[model samples]
Target: MLDWIFLFLTISLCLASRLLLSKLSNTSKKKQTLPPGPRYIPILSSILFLRRSLFDFEPILRSLHAKFGPVLTLRITSRPSIFIADRDLAHQALVQAGATFADRLTATEASRLLTSNRHNISSAPYGPLWRLLRRNLTAEILHPSRIKLFAPARRWVLDILVNNLKSKSETGDGVVVVMESFQYAMFCLLVFMCFGERLDEKTIRDIEAVQRHLLSSFVKFNVFAFLPKITKLVFRERWNSLLAIRQKQEEIFIPLIRARRDRKQQPGNGDGKNNSNRIFVYSYVDSLLGLQHPEDGGRKLSEGEIVSLCSEFLSGGTDTTATALQWILANLVKHQEIQAKLREEIEGVVGSEGEEIKEEDLQKMPYLKAVIMEGLRRHPPGHFVLPHTVREDVTLNGYLIPRGAAINFTVAEMGWDGKVWEQPMEFKPERFLAGGSGEGVDITGSREIKMMPFGVGRRICPGLGLAMLHLEYFVANLVREFEWKAVDGEAVDLSEKLEFTVVMKNPLRTRLVSRRKD
Candidate 1:
């Protein structure tokens, strides 16, 4: 009923807009030097878009790329989405001319609501605020030194994971669904980092439920992006649902925020919460608590904005790492020889099967690191990075990128380029070792972008180092604890699914046989 009403109200407006655009498009066609793409049919484009899922259009886009060239355009909606698959062009725009293309796409109504109208780091325009937030995250929370403080949290989460998997595999046919465990483990680690305290299982799981709901339902609310004035009225229920999710987040997050704020003031919390007088451990929230919003009269972050920031911190840390971990593990299960090789390396480096794998220990095993890198190269968590908006009109490889045009890099395509990798489709950890083409490659893409799983340039994820540590630590330990085996009649499927991240279409279900003698 609401849908019909909004469509009814917008139909005439859309037709009028289409007629106006058809005239403008024709005039601009002669003047525009934009990349080759399907001609926009205005109203027909909108109707066709309404019939398909947003991310489902990738196949069509790939075909379009093949027909047109490395750089092509698609007027997926009224806005043209420019995609870059060629490495040199990516380097030129995102690296050589990064400042010119550093701006993010204009946020939708839903995005603005969630990001507090660009309050957080990722969505904020390229400016002082983005710099501040990114710096704080990198220096205060994600710095290598700061990450060492969370070693205990990772260990605790690891114990919980190993125990959970062992118990899970013991049931029935002994095949365990691992994504749930992987995601939960990440939530455990990140929540501790965010809150500065160890929360109970119930609180951790509760937070996970709300945060995951917000991420999964994000696309559903993109409808609220269009005609939000009318859609907000028509889609009141959806709007309400979105608000409820946020409200739930605040209800949980604020108390945690307050507790951290309270902890800072509490003399004993600095020493930790016991008669033993534990030294106070600072947290991500603690850093935010001290920050004054650069734009808001230097006012401290509002409770709502803190909630938004915390949500961003938690979401980024959780889903992307968890998705990557599952993919790496799934690949290990499918390729037992690779698994055996990595296991041998782990045992050799760590000395004893019983000795825990430390970060320094990880540094000693290049092959273990190579396996994690290959997994990222093979299955980037996000196929295309968050769309980038150009700061001004610019030409790349003779194609015009108008000011404010949204650009995206085809991340998976770059990783799979046969020209870049001798055989890109095959899982090959050896590619990262000495004498291979991928040897000594830099992920930051400062010199040239070969493959970017966590993206690159000014807007590259600040959490890159921390994420790599988490992957290597977790993957190394998981492989150390269990000899992963494929379930008969249930092959390890590598097919992709479009989620908040590009996840395994079939979440990895594998048999875990204990390597440790009890």
Candidate 2:
């Protein structure tokens, strides 16, 4: 009888303990709720996402932010896209608690096609591979000390741009439309940096055409990101078109790649292939030739992978900088007083004629830096950064951000925040000057994320330093060389249209008056 009683007691205790553990698990689950967003009816929501391309998706998100709040979700794919428009929350997730939110989402079919299964720095996951690729670019190529080495190359491209504009100004009523020239000029410079060769005009243009085509077609390929198995079949022609573009890219780039590889493998330690142009001191391709994939059994990068990386390097450095140059010049043209003031500042620093404004002089001209900063603030080339993902479930502003979900920050909105800027819409360079609101703003978001034209955190654009130098170098030279004036009939439109980067809806058509007279 006593033995039976003890057995009953043990069974009772086991049941009570199990009940207690189950109740605790249920309570923990109740605390995690997704950020409020549009009700996802699956098919309809996906259709809406497909219809609204990256270029036009802002308007939809703006309305959602109003109803749900700054931190919200949009389930456009199997995964949710959470956009953070608030600066504090963005800082909280991207900086303060960075490790939990540092990973990138799995590359979609469209991205994988371009990046060679996520090998490039921009698309690679946040791990050993991403670290290796990013470090290679930053330390090997884009380091601040290394940028000065490209001074001659910058001058070469500047001459090409100036001459191109001059020839146009000499004819056709002298209203030189500048966007195409800006892009081509950037391509020529970057090509030399990437390939270790100063390719001829025809070759540079050929590469430019292919890259521009890919960038413009980016929006059209978004459908391939969702239900790609079915979408590839449904949008068969589009898929084939993308494939054809990639093939043409390989054809153009592979020979250049092979030539570099062959030259490096030549007799006498590559000395036989010494370049006459001083611009060949180091090339981006040379670094790539020596890189080994960390996770892929230490194998050298394949030809296709090299081409994809080269494509990223070329496209990234070319378009964004070129687009930014146009806007800075456009604003200079639109506001003549600001242009004259800028010219005066350049004069103060660059005292001699026939002598170029070297990168060194860029420091003395405070107003010149201000103009570039204001241009970026007023019109960041990309309104939103490349999407970021979380490594683990995280909370921002009392909302749960699930692991692996993509997060996008509102770049343009942050720059234009009324609380941040006095006259948010105005093209005012003064804002960045001393006593101005933007004075000493930290763009890297390492301290605070005032504006992230390049993005922030561990994955912040590795090319940030290079991009700035290019902008300052080009803008300073272009202004010092020419007096940009508005065309008589057409206005310098600030209205934006999304291309690979957001560009002026109506491209800048300006009349150039040469500031330098021989």
Candidate 3:
């Protein structure tokens, strides 16, 4: 009887201890109010929620925002990713508290490999290195003065694009797949800027093939980012394929880099050369070659770093701009009245079809600017900016955002907010014109939470200025040159597909007639 009593007491004590521990754990959890999110399955977390391709998550995210509030958490892998769909919260985090949200989240393995371990500006941690590289790009290559120097290059590429379209129109049954030509034109322009040489069509096509291969395969490589060791062991073939792609990238970029370095080492191309004469002659690689990182005791950039930077410059300038142009042109084709209005604005500012639309003329064309803005508002390139990490624990809208949480602001959602933009679904350039609802609006969300397609604050795109110039210049010229009309029985489909950029699902096939008879 005594032995039984002792056993019963011991069992009671163990049960009591477990209850106390459970209570404490519950109390701790209650104290930390995390953002609202969907119920996640154990171990797998939100992996099941994610599509194989990350780009497909945009619609899912939009749906989630509708179900939950603007700010929500998604446990992707082990980390709790906080997504902010509200513009005010985005401004609060990314703009008002810049430093808190400035640092880039730790890069994926594919990104690390592609960027040569965070050496490039886009993926680099916000620090002296990033500052230095950004300064070099801005002051040397991307400055207004430097951009003006590229006018001749732009004009040359414009002629090529026009000719290519003309050739296609003649061959095809009045319909042409214009995305290829648009992409090639952009690649040609950027390649010229990167290497200061007009490469042959074959070489340009080769570079395009490799870059597209890498970008398309990026989603596949993301598995390595999550389970590096496991992925390598289980999917060796896939790993090897990615490595082969990287090898091809090096094969293309390395020779170009070496040639530029060799040229810089020559006598005539030294610092004593006149700045005015070399403005257009100098390539992006030349400025990079001259950069010395103060954080690294004045160490010059390595070949790998140069390759990564040049690749970034080429891809960033080419792919995104080209995709945007396609979208803008598609909208113009879809809305004939909008197109007529834009053409009217362009002609009013820069004269007739025969006249060349100079970069300076773009400043006077506000409706043209509005159309570009409206396009970006409707279709942002990336649904999310590259993930950002919180530097320290912070309170956002009464919810606790802990340190080390990967945060992404929903760029497309903010642009489409009905509260901010009336008839957000409609393609209305008038909203951005004088005395309209969005007049004097800032793309950079500094003063208030509004449209931020290019993002805002210190971490905004360095190429924003250049991107705007390219868009305006290209759109004006294309409109001035061609009457882009939909082919008979073929309507312009604006259905979007997620690629490296958000592209048209059915690529814009249009009939282009030259405004001027050659």
Candidate 4:
């Protein structure tokens, strides 16, 4: 017993000493010449405040920026992270130094759970595979012609939503739709985008149920992700649940893929007899089947890669868009003047002759576009853009950001900066109009990061065009048909809570009266 105790003590001491020595060695190389930030601890660098309220991060970050200047060094876990609030510095990093910053590998739990990290655009590093997937998405699915093909899907969703609203008003039960209806609509649209056809409503519901469970499980586990590897072993149940979700998603997706393959392989007696009769592939699955790396000339995507990519598209498009739509509508509800003006513009331009508003019409309404931009800026759904990793040691504002450090930038901060906007806290659309400073601020461009709601640089959200279209189409039609006002006794709550995006803690509850007569 005495010998065993001695040996254990020796082993423990040696491990501690080695860890201390390693940390000290790394610390020795850090250049303290950069912008100032909180001092680093031995471990748990800046993680103590991660659990603070969603709104707290910005104020804290801004305080640091105020004291430290545009760039600051933050050590989250003994790893030096560089945070940039200055537009110039951010532009430099994203445009000029883009190759130096790439996506960090998703933690093991996130990869196993989200399935978003497996081989999808978001998870794949800056490399040949990433380029292949992004190019295929842009060329085959998100191209102008392909988006034009999706017009029918948008019309279908609009009809369903209008019918649902009419039914709710007739019943007069005052239904609390809380984000779920919005999420369902988004999921239906994106599911069709991924699978090339609409599944039955029951099928869509079943998939959503499983996905919600999986998302909740994934989010719960992600909070503890920065902990040591051994801590992950204790999270077996969460992992198991995630695997079950993966299995469920695969079961639904594989049959569709198999059907498409079998159809392509069918014998046609050399006459192409059934070619015209076969269901045309319109969604991203077709693109996946055709993808080839530009540099390598590799074969088509493997089954796992396809599954992961589809899952990422489904998940990304669903939650992010749903959250954003609700936020936009919530603002419209809070400010009726804004909604009325948008409806008036739509009516004047499109005129209600019973024709569905075409995609091309969205471009003609500058005020509506300004309102959308303001909503995106005021309430950026994603507060913290996905954390980026620095690949090499580099100096930003004279501070050394060491290689292999994980950095997270504040997206909402740039949009809400008081210096940039007059009365930044208020919801104002006029600020983004023709004569406004926001006129030339393209959210997609990296010339300067005035407000990066969709992020900036190479990793900017590729689906920004789709997101903007959804917002405009839905907002225009909803306003044309209904007058949104706050419930007499109940107010629209604007408080926020964080998940993948900054969502309203209390969903905006309001009365939707028909505008047909009003």
Candidate 5:
């Protein structure tokens, strides 16, 4: 009878403990109201909703937004990522409440290894270090004046591009795969800027190969990004591959860095007396070498940091610009009427006198600007911006956004919003004209977010000014020099496939015939 009494008491104690735990869990859930999302499953959560590849996940996210509203939570493993598809909300979060949402997301093991512990601008958290680096880049390398100094480099690359295309068109059956040539031209231009030396074709190609290989592998390791610690053990081969790529990068970039450093250290080079003009033409590496971080007590950047910055500079300028160039050129080929109009505009402003288009002439040609903007809107290089994180728990649209939650803005969706743009799917450059609906639309999205191809707020792309100049300069020159006609048998396909940037799936095959013999 005493044993039975003890057993009853033990059962009652267990029941009370379970009830108390349940109450606490309910209270916690009520305190922090997460946005509506798909039902969470144990361990897997919403990750099962993703595709085998992350590049193809944009469409799925769009569908989720349609069902759960513009703001929704996505529980990918243990982390909850909040995605914002509405333009106003994005402006509010990235601009008005900027600091609260200004921090960068925690880098994955692969990203950390690639970025050298988040030293590069895109991956760097919002802090003094980011500001210093960004200011140095803008003032020293990417300023309008600095960009003007690289005019010769641009001209050299353009000449090479024209000559190669002419030769290929003459030899081949008027159908040439122009993507490789375009990529090489862009690489050459950026390499000259990064290293301050015109490298031979072989070296440029080697660097391009390694960079592209690493970029291609980045998306493939998406699973490892979330489950980094465990996946390192489970996916040993992939982890090793990433390490090898990093090692290869170091090997290539270090020599380039040392050469520049050695040159700067030479007696006359430092005085800025004998080589004043040359010294004025500073490369990105020169600026980085001189940077002394205040937060780190005047600590100079390490070799690894230099490599990561240089790699970022090269990759950021080349791949995205090349991809955008292809899309713009392809559109010109597809819409012959629009192409004719643009050529007419170019010829009108800077006559068909066989002279290269000057940067100053770009301001006079509104149609040309319109065409480029339209292309960016239709085919943004990145479907989504790099993930941003909240510094503290904040409320957005009356929903609690807990601290450390990852957030991303839908770049492509904002551009394609039918509510803002009339006939959003149609390729209409006229929409950006003076009297049109999108006239005076700001790409930065500070005042209002009509369209944001380069993003906005404190983290807007520092290279915006340079990127615009490159696009306009190249597009105008290409059209002026050649009549880009679609191949008779092989038409231009606009279908896109995801890479580091969204590139043409079939690649652009076109017929190029020089308008002027000169």
Candidate 6:
């Protein structure tokens, strides 16, 4: 009986091997007509080549493009994936074929853990619900009037940042400003904006701390994010940690969300102290609260959903803008002549001795605008602006990209591509200023982009206005207050390192010489 069972097992193994070989042969035949790429090896694609240096994915891709034309397919765990770096092809995929290219992050579980299953505008599919949420966000919360209404909040945050930086500059070991500190300050302000005038600094810090902690465990979290199905068995520890962090986040955000709701529904008492007569600034939360889950006509978002949306606000605004500000400063420090010219423009417009720089004043400073633009071109915060997925079957440059394939366009590569700009590596703000080789280069997302720091297409950042304000305002102020030099003798190392955002592997350490022209 044992001999018979062994023979049966051997027969079964032989049949399974033949079936696998037949499938491979068929797949190879189909791929022959598709764009040329490296030959696929079973299971090793993910381990050998698919996992790219997140920061420098562009260069590797460009090399691939050089070897095998613009559009090429790569295998991830035997799955065919498409990457587009060619400008025209990218436009076809992203803009003309907008709805066809949906967000391809397949970790529904990760989204659930991170966002508590809230139908976030970023996470929602291309449909009526997405349209509703996007419209609400655009019309109510992110509108020009609504943003202007939050002027107090912006001012309050800026004050905190400036004062805090000034205090640090005065005392501690030669005024070392961690770029992350600016991010923290921005995070605090946005938290207030989302939650209302609620959370104290310590409470806010705890929330921020958890976010940072979770972020540090990103590899562990992403292991789950990429393979959500195997997450329970494979990354149970990281998965649980992520869920735990989500719970902690809820402990803080839920009360604030509920309180705001309560305040809205509760009648105003006669006492002015209990004044419920406040006008709504029409924030992101307010817009979300008004949404209905179209599938079942479900009620507005639960606590978890609200938390995820708010998390995006804080995460999105903080890291991108703050890292951008740091890069702009580092560049200014590196190129003193440009910095001098910027300060001259700012001082000429606002006077060297002013009480504070106003928002209106930023418009008149064209050089400042150019400097900021140059910085974004030089150092885009999100290296690849959250991987956009192909939603439906599409062809780019005669190559077919099937639905559900992950697509990543090279942002940093586009910015530094020598084909687009001469001296692409040089820190030249004048490239963006008026007449230059890059005179026609469109930084505005209205047109097909040569470089996309805030991303391109329908998914372009709505906070462009606010982000510009922060960068220009803070940078102009910092340069005006101090003449930044690379710590007298030490060179400001320009080596790039990838984190949540690209930061200097060696942080920008510069000596601040007082530029008080008193």
Q: Model 3, range 263-290, lDDT digits (tens) per residue?
A: 6776656563444444326889989887
TM-score of each: 0.95, 0.91, 0.91, 0.88, 0.92, 0.88
lDDT of 5 at 68: 97
Model 2 residue runs over 4 Å out of place are 1-30, 267-280, 352-354
Which candidate's lDDT is highest? 1
lDDT of 6 at 389: 74
Error of 3 at 74 (Å): 0.8
- Which pairs, if any, clash in model 5? none
Tens digits of per-residue lDDT for model 1, 1-518: 65755665595587688778778765654565789998977656765565555468788888989999999988766677798989889989888998888899888888888888888988999987888888988999998888998898899999999999999999999999999999998999999999888889999989999998998888778776567787788778989999989888889999889988876886565555534576566789999998887777988888888888999999999999999999999999999999999988888887545556888889988998899899999999988888889877788998889877779998888888988898899999999999988899999989988899988899898899999999999999999999899998878889988888989888899999998886
Pairs of colliding residues, candidate 6: none
- The regions of model 4 sitting more than 4 angstroms off are 1-19, 23-35, 42-59, 106-109, 112-117, 175-178, 223-229, 264-279, 292-299, 352-354
Candidate 6, 1-518: lDDT as tens digits: 45334433443455457558777774644653556777765434443332444555555667888999867766644456676667766677677776677554554566656865536667666677667766776787667776776777777777777666666667766746557568877887777767656468888888788777766566555444333454455546657777788788788777877876765454452232245565444456655666787766667767777777787777778888888988989988888899889989988988888746777888898888888988888888876766677666666776777667667777776788788778988889898877865665666544666788877776777677778887887788777777877776678787788877887888777667666643
**Lowest-scoring 10 consecutive residues by lDDT in candidate 5?**
42-51
Spell out the clash pairs found in candidate 2: none
1 or 6, which is superior by lDDT? 1
Error of 1 at 185 (Å): 0.5
Q: Once superposed on the true structure, which residue ranges of model 1 sit more than 4 Å away at CA? A: 1-12, 18-30, 48-54, 268-276
C-alpha lDDT of all candidate models, in order: 0.87, 0.84, 0.83, 0.72, 0.84, 0.71
Query: Could you tell me the lDDT of residue 435 within candidate 5?
Result: 87
Estimate, for each residue in 54-119, the C-alpha lDDT of model 5 and write its tens digit.
457778888999999999997664567888989999999988987778789888888888888989
Model 3 deviation from native, Cα RMSD in Å? 7.8
Model 2 per-residue lDDT tens digits across residues 1-518: 45324433443455457558767775664678889998765555555666676658888878888899999998776578899999888888788877777788888798898889998988988899889888888887898777777888899989999899899999968889899999989989899989878888788889988988898888778877765676676778889999999999999999999988877665554443344423235788888999998998999999999999999999889889999999999999999999999888888887636368888888888898899899988889999988888877777898888888889999988888898899899999998999999999898988877888888788787877888888998888888888899998777789999888999999999999988785
How far off is residue 143 in model 5, in Å?
Answer: 1.1
Give the lowest summed-lDDT range of ten residues in model 2: 271-280
